[model samples]
Target: MKNAQKPDHMSLNSLVNRLKDGRYVIPDFQREFEWSPKDIQELVKSIFRDYYIGSLLLWKGKTENFDALSCEGIYGHQQNGGAEYIVLDGQQRLTAMYYAFHAPEIRLPNRANRAFYFINVDEFMRENFDDAFEYHYQSKRLQRLLDSPKAQYESHQFPLSVIGTGGWDLLKWVQGYTKFWEEYPNTEDDNEDHISAEQAEVYAVNGEQFGQYIKEITDEYQISYIELDQQLGIDKVCDIFTQVNSRGIRLDVFDLMNAMLKPKGIQLKQMYRDVMPNVDWVDTDRMNVYVLQVMSIVLQSYCSPKYLYFLLPGQLKPIRHSDGRREQEILVQSTDEFRDLWDKSVSSLVRSIEILKHPNEYGAISPKYLPYASILPVFAALESHIWTLPALERLDGTRKMKHWYWAAVFTNRYSGSVESTAARDHQDVQEWIADDDARPALLMEFENRMRNLDLSREVNTSSSTYTGIFNLLVLQGARDWISGVAPQFDDLDDHHIVPEAWSKKHLPGNTWHTILNRTPLTADTNRNVIRDRLPNQYLPEMFESSGEESMRSILASHFISSAAIEILMRRDFGPNDFEEFINERQRTITDAIQDLLIHERLDLSPRLRELDLDIERVELALRELVATNLEDDSERIPSGVRQKVQQRFEVAAKKDPSLDPENSRQMSSLLPHFDIRDIQDTLTNKILWPVFSSSFTSKSDLDLKFSQLASLRNGIRHSREVDDVTRMEGEASVLWFDKILTK
Candidate 1:
């Protein structure tokens, strides 16, 4: 970190230009790419807004090598000036800007902050746009004062910042900050100095208080990225990337796709630029970052296997190394295969979720499994021809029943390990396949269990086994989906059906699967979905208010899934959409599962209705027995309560098949499903630990704990009591009701 000799700006500048040539990409040994969507957005804002972007500093040295980095993103510098290109700072911004600016359209692959546009121009325009005009960068209302093309060209660094949202916004912010400081220094604090409250009140140049602030800056300054050297190797370049750039802005999943897919064919590039921004029935805002994490893993298998995760511009990407271009190519291919496995993936996922309901999903033995990856099951289900009208009646019975769990487990593995070089290396993977005997042993036992004719066995959600297999299918499916359209399995992100906070707020984090948090989406579309704070059925405008036409158009086009749209209409609400969101998600998820699985022979309609209305009638013959757990007789239960319970049971039995017979519980046992133990294991591993705001309180009391729940419960419960329509009950809803009443 010692300061080197200070060469003249021109000397340093000359070296800088050479360091940026294509050959000087980052060296194989460096830190992983780390940045988040929020960071990405902030960086864009800073540069476009014109706040002083930091300088790139470099030292002369051949540092220790760690791993490998991709050859793209960093321009190569001539080694004539130095042995290895050295980077001082601004690596993140440089990499991001390089890739983003080159691409005609770059969508944030992260579910968040993907919406900002990079300047898109044809090749001729890209090379000559500056030559055609009196390119002026107005700062402090300071125009470039251009007299000729030479003056504009020689004025400063090339107009590296594209004239678009990401670039323009950053330029504006910096310029605004500079102008204010230049005009009225000493008026106030440092960052916001040079302007007074009185002036702000008049012209409204407040400290990012109003939207106009960004506009004001953008109106004046244009981003000027000054690279001191283009000849620097990636190792040195990365040092700069790690240092100064934009503070908070980083790349998302889409950014990863752009980086890895940089050299792929034009068709691939077009797909990346255009089609990848529009995934079907996926919500990018809620799951973009997590999706990026998954894609990073997938992409790494192809071009830059070891450090593909590091390819992300900022935070949240998981890779930990430098050189990984070869690894990245392998990942790309693998991801393409995975996308092709979409149907099977979704099936495996749904089944795993069902297993989660069994309360064994997070059991001690397989507590690592998360429902998120269970998506792979959907793929398996499809592979097994489960997407047809009827599912497979039976598979071979195996001991451990891990057959249903492989997809989910694989998905979890994919998401977790891609960032680690050793984990992602081809040699390591080969060894794993050959030596991971524990899982192989379990798979043998699982197939044996599957062979038994248990057509009626319900899917178990809690079993880590089921969730694991589901993820595998999801990974596979994702690979399949992107192959033909997107090269090297690039530009995908997970989309949230509901915003992530829903799970974080309503369920324990332990109950949540990182994989479960996302569904693959095109990177650009992912960015469009930044936060998913708004209900999907009616997307809100970021700037302007939505009129009726826009609202109608949104629900019709974007909802994509018919059931999701229906669910929105059914909810009949707009106030405090967070609550409506949860309800709508129930319908969306159930329908998607049914549609995708096709063979489970599920009836999604039942899922659309609320769960609270379901009731299990107590059999007169079994009441005495079922009640034993509730009683010290009168000692534990008050007379009024016992009477009410008995009365309710009597009423339910009048038309309820579960209670009409002498042995209703016995009759219920005959229903078709998977192994009871398997289901039980799933529930234990997963659902056993769901959290609620009112963990120990009833649904009626849930409101008192958190305002969101309180209002939701009140709305749903009260609306029902006042309803005139008849309702049918489903087990899922019944489960929901039971949790509410018991907790």
Candidate 2:
């Protein structure tokens, strides 16, 4: 079978010679040259130190059976039925070594030009080994090192390109050095101006030593290789390649796929390069693996959770009944089928990216904050049906699909176990298209999931999910609070409404990054105009400078309530009043988010009706609680809350001009103008016990129920969608109220 083989040691000189004669070649499946100069420098250092660089694994093949790829240092030539060594492992290291020692110029990662050279070889040998291995690609640094006086005297700065070839001769170099000193003799014995005879002799001796050192490095340095038997099948060769390369820079599934495609004259990497530029929404560097995975998923139809393993050559073996070795099945067989599937997948992906580019639609300006790339396959699956629908129907379908996309993003649908989620969603989408009720059912599922979204707390702007949410909010027509202009998609900045410095000073340990405290602002406004001043000090000045109506428009655009704006305009605004302002703004933001999510007026009546209490009685009870709390003390109500309430009354009166005079009189008579907080506090306090005394066993029990009610009310008022547990607590509170009211 010709299976027995042994490891072979080859010198660098012999390898270079074989490379020159085109006997050594790289296989088509091997990855392209990817090592940086730093990698090459490390290899050279390891060689000089005699450390163990990894062995080269090669496939010995007849020159006629396989065509070799022409690389930087390896070329193609006709062979007369001779054996050629095809590199399977250590392609990167071999390529680096070849280029460093042979190639004149090398192209870097970004297509920048560079050349490699050894600096001060004599000094390199004498100095600390760690510091001796110095190499550079920058032009200015290379030029400076080459032009140094040390380089002139010590024969340093050896260009590696011509080292082993006829272009450079070490013996001739030594003879030239000896002849130069003899022709221009320096007999003055001067230390600086002229070279002394002794210095000249020392230079000659070092030159000879330098020639010998070059010989030792290039000719004497040995590298080991494990050459596989030439008769092994390609599958076995691939398996051996994978096993031997398990430790460092192992072959990815794409590499094996490339190997399979090579026999049919296809390059997988070139295919990627061609398709990537056509898809504008993909970041080439980060999204390449994901793009390949998406193609694999679409072609396979079934979600291979470990797709990399599945695609590996000879990875799937048939079951054996204790009789014989089983033959492996091929996952991908035909090249034409692969090409067709690849074409369809790319076409669908491009269409999906186009769907997200509409300005009035998703408006996905960049891929930086795409929450999940797996959603691409789902959209691609939907594209098959979307194209068949009538124009108007297509528009509607796209809108629904976009809604689902946003929902999945906000809900983190594809976070963990992404492939499993994608597979399930793929089937669900198919069913959704099959049945008419499925669309609304899917949307309801989205809404149900979204109901748990509460932006009352701080959001990390760096999180991809949160970033996508921010982008969605902007797409839904969110405008800057300060400018009254829609923020430029690329230029928006997150600014603290209550400045961070103020919060740290007055409300330490409180969250300063809550959704209510943040607003999208232009970079100029955020950085230049509103530096670190408290809102109370800056907002009033803005109102004065920009006028009341314009300022009101600006605040309204940011979802700030009309009442909150009126409070900010008060001349007696105080720094301590910021907490109340934050609470009010949080409520406004919560309401705005609800509108964005569902695109309809949020109905809490159904949820509230579950309590089965007298509506008028509840309102009257809350009003009475507010009135009694403020009956005696003028200092109890905060000035900001009072001003906000009066502003609401004035604004209401202005809307109905006939009631202006009566509203003025009513405002003067009302001692403490009440807001929602006063009612919430009253409902949560022991003072409300008499209103619901029949429903409770004790004061503590009543307090607990009311506390839960207070929490639910706050969540509802702030526009947060509560979870099932919160809904249950709310229902229980309502039941307690129903019992007391009936009694």
Candidate 3:
């Protein structure tokens, strides 16, 4: 019997050919293909990522066995009478591979239309797996795109059907794609729709790179299989198949745990069923697994599937002592003790969900808005422990937990490998809750990420940051426009502040769909009040009905400041107004996040960052003025000023040996080091005054602005205090310089 079966592996290329030739067959008892396009897309991603796609169990087919269990070819495999192996397991994965590789015209499971797959070469080059692979159902628009090679090349989307044909097909496609882009300029206007040589080269390089990856994955990637001998009797094969698949399903870790616990008289499934009603508010696909995870976390401070075995009754757990010593101990000595832990985990999870759902608290109005369900077990375990602290300590701990939750969500800490991150966060957050100084490292990371985060690009709702921002908007008591009251949580919809219909028609950019332009509004308000109208068209009507002052307060709840409201109220509002409004709202939203979630003052990071960039503009203007006029002998720099710079360089050269007076580029580099006053002097010089005059208003105006800017720069550079009024003046000066110099 041992010799009846042997393990063998096949390259992905060979496997695809076998499926195409109808060499592999699925028994009638095997379930039909049930994979969604998303499931197939994920499988493709895994194959390309070199992840193990798991082994197959194939029975060497016999006529009698085929008769006993009516074998059929894989989906979209039209060829017949070539069956060599009968698939016993991994049918879903096998069929998914066939569907993706063959580019079948069959409908996806439960979907209406046939699906087609493509890889976005640009995103693939960036390794953005989430956006790189996509499957689209048949549509006129999609068909048009698929038909046009020029559109395909421009979009960087390569049809996967090319891979199905094998041998030089992908190479030919890549060459065609490259040639199309390289010659695109001949057919298009260079001034309006130019494709630079550099951009065309990028497309060619990405295509060749992608083709190489496809070849490597198809030719070298292996799929192992256990081949059962054909000589085996049909009865034996039937028994083997039944053994592998009982009750039409495979056993997962939870089922295995239940099997292991049966003799100990503990029904883990029954315990989970009992807890389900209590945790009805917590929306998780795997509540049963989460129960075990919470128990594992509370017991051993770990919750990976491997670690869950330690929680089994009488299983040995290595315990660490306060003296840095370890001892082995049984985690669960009896079934009653296991039940007690389960009960406690369920109770704590209930409390955690309550906190998460409470609008005044964490404000995940529903499970859909919850940024990361993977963090729940650790959060529940920690929540239970926090409540056990003294009253004063408990209050502080809860406050810190809020910060930790927001930090984890915004930083996307639990996006991958949730077990280790959850365990680490559990420990780090607990420590942070007890000691104010012991801030979790994630807070610092979140602060750094937020400083440069382009909120306008966060248009995808699936992103953790995008959802976190929505939850924050919900927490603001976002009132309905008509009723001027917070709507029921379930009734609220994430609607666009700047109407998407108007933006699509008027604006050139796609920022209207960004989180910066979205907020929680009641469905009634969205459908009845908003209804495809511009903010200027609708907001004033609401202002007249709700009163302008009351409307301002209501808009403020949605992070719309008075500045943004003014822009939105513009009767002649256009793309610039939309840009200015969203930018203002972004600042207001960021300020709220800093004040509430991060527990810090809204620092001038973005403004200060912008200030630094504008200062570079000032320096570059000075350099261009000096460099352009140098050879012309404009005397922009007087003899006295030249001597002053040379004297300064001599002193500087004595301190630093790298100072090269001979190199023109190195000499020009010293222009950036000149103080603002030096820049003003160079700009306002009598000879250079005419050249700089067109950029600035006048010498007196430049003097007044530059002087204020110099004080602001010195204070900011040297870590000295600058008052609000001085900061505002400095902002004006920076804006004035940026506009004039950038032009």
The Cα local distance difference test for each model comes to 0.34, 0.59, 0.78
> In candidate 3, what residue range of length 10 has the lowest lDDT sum?
597-606
- TM-score: the better of candidates 1 and 3: 3
Taking the tens digit of each residue's C-alpha lDDT, what string does model 2 give over 1-743? Answer: 45445599887778666655556666665666777677777677667555456578876776443643332224223433333777777777776666666654445555566656463545554543444555666588667754653443345455554454642555565455555444446656534457667756665666666667667866778889988887777778777766775665645556666776676777877888888877756543434445555555554443432453344333452445567866656664666666665677778788777756543456564565456665676667567556767764564455455556666776667654355556555665555555433443345555655555555544665454565555655555566556667777578777787788767776656567765667677888887888897667788778788887887777776667778776655666554456566667756755554565454322234454333233324534545544564553433434554455556555444433333435443433333344435444444446454643444457676567666666665555333355677767866775675565455
TM-score of each: 0.22, 0.44, 0.57
Residue-level error in angstroms, candidate 2, position 267: 1.4
Q: Return the candidate ranking by lDDT, descending.
A: 3, 2, 1
Q: Estimate the TM-score for candidate 2.
A: 0.44
Q: Mind giving the per-residue lDDT tens digits that candidate 1 earns over 78-123?
A: 2232234344444555555443333223334433322222211121
Residue pairs in collision within model 3: none
Runs of candidate 2 exceeding 4 Å displacement? 1-250, 280-286, 293-337, 354-359, 390-392, 439-445, 480-484, 566-586, 599-743
* Candidate closest to the true structure, highest lDDT: 3
**What value does the lDDT take at residue 542 in candidate 3?**
92
